[model samples]
Target chain A: MSAPKTTRAWILSNPPTDMPDESTFKLVEQDLSELKDGEVLVKTTYLSNDPAQRGWIQKGVIADRMYFPPVEINAPMSSFGIATVIESKAADFPKGTLVNCLTNWREYAVIDTTLGAPYVTRVDPIPGFKETHFLGALGLTGVTAYHGLENVNVTKDDTVVVSGAAGATGSMVVQIAKKIIGCKRVVGIAGTADKCKWVESLGADVCINYRDADFKEQLIKQTEGYVEVYFDNVGGEILDLMLARVKRFGRVSACGSISEYNNSSPPGFKNWFEVIANRITIKGLIVLDAGARWPEMIKEISEAAVSGKIQVGDANETIVPTAFEDVPKTWLKLFEGANTGKLITHIV
Target chain B: MSAPKTTRAWILSNPPTDMPDESTFKLVEQDLSELKDGEVLVKTTYLSNDPAQRGWIQKGVIADRMYFPPVEINAPMSSFGIATVIESKAADFPKGTLVNCLTNWREYAVIDTTLGAPYVTRVDPIPGFKETHFLGALGLTGVTAYHGLENVNVTKDDTVVVSGAAGATGSMVVQIAKKIIGCKRVVGIAGTADKCKWVESLGADVCINYRDADFKEQLIKQTEGYVEVYFDNVGGEILDLMLARVKRFGRVSACGSISEYNNSSPPGFKNWFEVIANRITIKGLIVLDAGARWPEMIKEISEAAVSGKIQVGDANETIVPTAFEDVPKTWLKLFEGANTGKLITHIV
Candidate 1:
């Protein structure tokens, strides 16, 4: 197949001070250059819009010492997604190969396989699963939940509480904690009643809508005021509340702080003393660090899916597909809580 | 020896919201009751005042699910101190036994050894050491520092930062981390220049006064912006600041939060997201939980002291002696940073 002459891409124009808007990115047409040795020209299939993107685009203090370096000004925004290699100089990733990698917000991207522009891994499409499943249940999202729970040594004796339970990573955490880990109870926290119901359907014993007037009271009642493990995705009032709600010797997996990503100045924790009083242990995690263990995570998740222990329904049900031009809008939807699970942009 | 018919004690009159004051406690004379089986009448010699008492006096949400139950209204304020058993019905604590136990702010206390009013352990007074040594270097304060540092596995490779570095536990931490653990570097944080100098005198490589306008910058410069382990004695802005200052995969031992102890609504951490970004691990500790390991800690500390590896100077230098009737005022001094080291009420 002949390489495409031009590619349309979205570049970060102005960094967002608070919530990102249309002005945060600029869509442009870029001319493609010939691929170098050990580089592959990949046709982007899907673009992932994750809450983590908000942190990556930040500048100054917020961007300092971050896990991933901030996206440079006027650089193509990056996402973890699916792509098809059409032309390649690299032996590992040849033509007609389906791979998952850190893809740019462009239709065609040249991936340096040898130098490793982030990373490139060839993924075998599961027979019954959609391609987007590799970005959700069987990918980094799944690995994050799996490794964090493992890090904390969550067991069947634990009553697990997961924040952002309706989102992709959180939904997987809910299922994995309940079905695979066999935790005594799995309680989820979501933003809306519908999201709560969806989280409950995904094997959470109960899901509390955090927007309720008596949300904390409800959490106290459901978990009996003693959560053994808390998988925190939202950092703000919820994180503080969980600190107070957890029992003595509680373990916290600090996954993501989606709630505070948009805020320039995030609020501090008021119930932090509970950490000392209860002898709690809070650990932060980054899924990218678990690259070596991805195969293991994928194997277990695939087996569970095959056995109907996890992903009982359509794995693609949670993926909200958006047009490529509307990628920035779809990314903004994450903060607005518009998309239920995973939000993906399908290139036309 | 016959027990006294009456005893003077300080009781919690009202819980303070921001800071404990003169009116927060009441001194009263109580009629002593006859000793029962397994009970010993103890004459309080020295009362150890701690920042933890501020948390113990809190009511409502702040006191909820605390490791130690809150001091009840009108109940005697408790502390760890030295006492001499004058009269006893307990075989374990015969008359004239010098012991260390949870003592009230009073001249005399009746201890039920078998029932274990908190706990009572016979502390053999070292021939060359002052009796107050048992309350500082050889007591819970030292144990807190030793165990917390050990809990985080602070090794020679670690560059440790300790908050409240001039206070009892903090001073011990500075000495132990540097002289015993032999860490690469030990940085201390205190409120004033004199306290910082005192902290540095205790084997800390450098001590920064947190009150300085460029305190954070000073900490960054001193530690090269990468602290491997943080022994957090003060929680609030400093805790949040250290979260950002620590290296990736850094370990934090949450020993105490003297900064937030008196605040009814303690401030939240603005830099809390650093936990997720850096993959930090924060573990809370309670010295009371390390009872079984006390012998191990005490032996190591004793050996270190004798070898001049820890407590090289006069062990009693940090003990700020006050009159028994002024116990509450002595405790208030802890928040004001009035006392240089350990504040103890010397009963006349």
Candidate 2:
């Protein structure tokens, strides 16, 4: 079989503005390179659009120095994607296999899976679920949610408050906490009114819009009792606010700080003293540390999905497959808070 | 037995300046009160002068809350003390039984043991070592160090960094970590050159003075690798400095923040971002939480002491039996940093 001469992809031509705009990324066509020995050629099936992707493209110092090598000018930008192994010389993976491969936002690419950090795994398609679920509920976001809840040892009686509740990880957290642990109350804080409703639909007992004028007061009133476990996804002000309401011996799982990721200046909390007064236990976790237990997590999430106990929104839920050329535009939509659930691109 | 008609005690008539003067505390004589059922009358035997007590009185705050009850204009002040059960109506504790009691700063006190928090049990002469060890190495301070280390899971391969290395809890932590875990290296940060030497003698691989202008730089240099465990006793800037050098998955047992306890406006760290990037875990612990494990900790400290693996500093080793009227004056010495090691008063 002959490979296509050209492939479509999006490149970050400029850094994002206050709110990322379509101009930030430029769609382009590039010549496809032939696969070398020990390499596998793949075609993007589902491109995962996540909030964290916004930070990866920004030009600034991050707390953990978590910036990707600056997105080169006019080059296909990299991201987590579910791709199909069209051809392979690797022993473990065979051609024509549906695999969840984290790669660039391009229609096709050649990868030396043996050397690349983006792990590629064979996907066993589950009935009634779209391949995109692998980009979400069955993927990194789901595992992260599971790890946070498990690491903090969230229980049924725990009053868990999740920030960024409508985001991928946060949404998964709410569903897992409510369905798996049967938490007494699951509160969600999202950026928009619609996001709040979506979080509530995910079994959150209460959902608050952080954009509300009286957000702090309303949050305190809703969570009148002290918070037992705070699953922090969006940090900065929300984290500081939650710190004040944490009960004695409370646990805080620092999963992500999306709020501060794009801030021009470092944000500081004025009431960190609560960490001492209440004897709160705050722990930071990266999903890589949870790799040791990923298989177990995948099994649990798969069972939950099969039993219909965990809802992953909808399967046919599709955003118009933005061309690889439109990766920047699709990313801008995410930053503008226009996309709900997961955003993916179907490579031609 | 006829009790004395007048008992001598010390009362804090007014809050003192930088260092408390003898005149700041008033010595007075008062008539003894009758003991009730379930009550034991005790004479002060070993009055523990701890740095925490200084913070309590000087700032009127302990653990971020008001510590002082109004002085009532002219009555004696109450404080924690180790006393002997001179007269008792309680069955468990009989008259002439040596007990570690919490009492007022008076020659004698009628205490209902049921209403007080127990500090220690009736032991056989507390060995030939100073009975004051019961207040330091074998008592609350020692237990605090034990719980912090155990809860944080400090291991042999871990690099342990402890602040307030010369103070009661700090000194105990350095010794316990060195002797019990066989940690790769134990670094201590103290306030004075002399205290640094004391910490070094306690088996601290490196002891740096926080008073130095290049304190933060020196701390980074000393902890050339990464800090795996940090036992924080002095919180403010020193805690911030250590926080910056903590490696991924580092654990911080926040025992106390002595530096900020006295400051009217406590300074905060700007680099809390490290908590996320490095995946550090910060836990605040009060020794009371480790209630059932007190005996275990005492056994461990005792073994280390008996084995000559750890040495208690000699700066404040002097034990004097003084009338209760001297407590306020003696406590003032702790505030002035004039006394070292563990300062205790024996009841004659």
Candidate 3:
């Protein structure tokens, strides 16, 4: 098949002065070059929209070192994506294979051995499963929640509290605590009543809206035994509240700090000594840290998804199929609290 | 010998509105009752002056619980101290036995089975060690340092940074990392140049004065390769600075926050995301958490002390023998950067 001469992609123009908006990224049709030998040609299917996208647009790291290089201005935004292998010269990556890779916010990509080992991983689309699951529930979002829960060394009687309850990872953590760990009390912290309802649906014993003025009182009343594990996806005051509620030797996973993403600096917290006096373990995690284990996790989450144990938010009901150009705008839905489960950009 | 009819003690009058001073506690001569069965009457030799004492004086906890109960008003100010068992009615404890217990800020205490287990553990004075070492270096100070280094899983070649390096726990952490773990580079953070010298004498490879104007630049430059472990005793901007200097997956022991002890709420930190991106583990520890292992730690630290491996500050030159009334003034020295090593009150 003749390769397409051009493709559509989104490129960052300049760092946002404040909150990110449509102007932050410029969508354009770019010229495509011929695929080289030992390379695979792939058509992007689904793009994962995450709060981490804000981190990428700005600086993903501090001055000392970087977890990974940030997206440079004028460069096409690259993130975790699922695609269909259309053509392949690499013996191992056969044509028709579904793959997950750092596909740019573009329609097509050509990856080779130089693209590095396991970066272009082959993914199997499970029968009777939504293909978007490969981008979220069976992908980074679920894998991250799986890890956040794993970090706690959860016990059947342990009480687990998860912040950012309605988000992708938070929702998965709430369910996994009940279905997998059999935790006694799984409390969730969210921003709205609707989000709380969604979190409760995911098996959380109690869901408190942090936006409420009585959040602290509500949190104390709901979690009487004190939290044994805190899955913190939202940092700032929400994390502080949970810190106060954590039992001695409790585990906290600093999965994401979405609340602090808009601000240049972290806000003050009063209960820091709680982290010390309680002997609480606070850990930061990156899903990519679980590296080569991705396939194993995929299998596990896939089975869970098939068993109807794991749930996800697909962009189908929210986005129109023909309006692919509006994909960049979909990212805003994450920060706006409009999207549920995994936010995805459906290309086909 | 007959027990005294009355004993002199310092009692908490009320919760301090601000920094702890002589006014927070009231000295009183209270009536002493006869010891009950299983009780041991002990004469206090030393009073531990710690930053944690501030937490013990306030509403120790937030709402639900506290790691330790607050010092009650109209009662003796109870904290860690070493004493000589002058009279005993318990089988495990004998008269003249040197022991460590939650002795009040007074000249004597009566402990029994009802007083709880392990709170009044017996200690044998090492042949060549000073008795004061039990309240400082070889006691909770050394054990806490040991646990902090252990949490990081320190390797021989690892570089470590200890904030408040001249203070009790901080000094021991620096020494233990160097002498026990054989860590390659041990960096210490102290307030004054004199304290830095003392930390260096304790085997720290380098000691930086946090009060110095160029301290931040010096820290960033000295830790150019990044620190594998950070034993934080003075949390605040110093913790923030070290957070940026920590290597990926590095361990941080929130041993204490002497700087924030006076504040009702902690200040904001700007580089907290560094902890997340780097996957660093920040743990708050209470030395008592070791529980059954305290005896083993005590034995090990005592061995190190006898071998002249763990050095201590016994106030041989600084503390005058006749000034018993000046005991509470010693605690103020910790915040004022006046004392070296462990600040202790010796009752003649």
Chain B TM-scores per candidate, in order, are 0.94, 0.85, 0.92
Of the two candidates 1 and 2, the one with more favorable DockQ, higher being better, is 1
**Winning model by TM-score:** 1
* TM agreement with the true structure for every prediction: 0.94, 0.77, 0.90
Provide backbone clash counts, one per model.
4, 2, 1
What docking class should model 3 receive? medium
In DockQ terms, which candidate is top? Answer: 1
Candidates ranked, most accurate by TM-score first: 1, 3, 2
Candidate 1 residue-wise lDDT, B1-348, digit = tens: 455988988898887777778898998998888999988889988888888877788756345578777888888997888899999999988899987887778788888787552268887766566777777777778888998998889999999999998888999899889988899999999999999888888888999999999987898798775889999999988988898889999999999898887776677676777898899999999888777777788878888887777763453344556787677776777888776667676766
Clashing pairs in 3: A276-B284
Model 3, span A1-348: residue lDDT tens = 676778888888766734777788888888777778878888888788888767767644443455666788888886777788888888778888888887878888877735653466777656776766666676677778887777657778888889888887888888778877688889988889988998897788989998898988999898777878888897888888788888878888898888887777667777788888788899988887777666677667777667877554442113324255777777777777776677777776
* True-vs-predicted CA distance for residue A120, candidate 2, Å: 1.5
Q: For candidate 2, lDDT tens digit of each residue in A54-118?
A: 65666543434442344555666768787778888887667887767656777887767776322
Q: Weakest 10 consecutive residues, lDDT, candidate 1 chain A?
A: A312-321
Question: Individual DockQ of the candidates?
Answer: 0.66, 0.23, 0.63
lDDT of 3 by residue, B1-348 (tens): 777667788888867745778888888888777888988888888777778877777744453445777788888886777788888888778888887888877777777635653576777766766777777777777788887777667778899999988877888888788987789999999889988888888899999998899999999888988988998998888898888899998989898887787776667776777778889999888877777767687677777766878665453113423255666676677688676777777777
Q: What TM value does model 1 have? A: 0.94
Using lDDT as the measure, the top candidate is 1
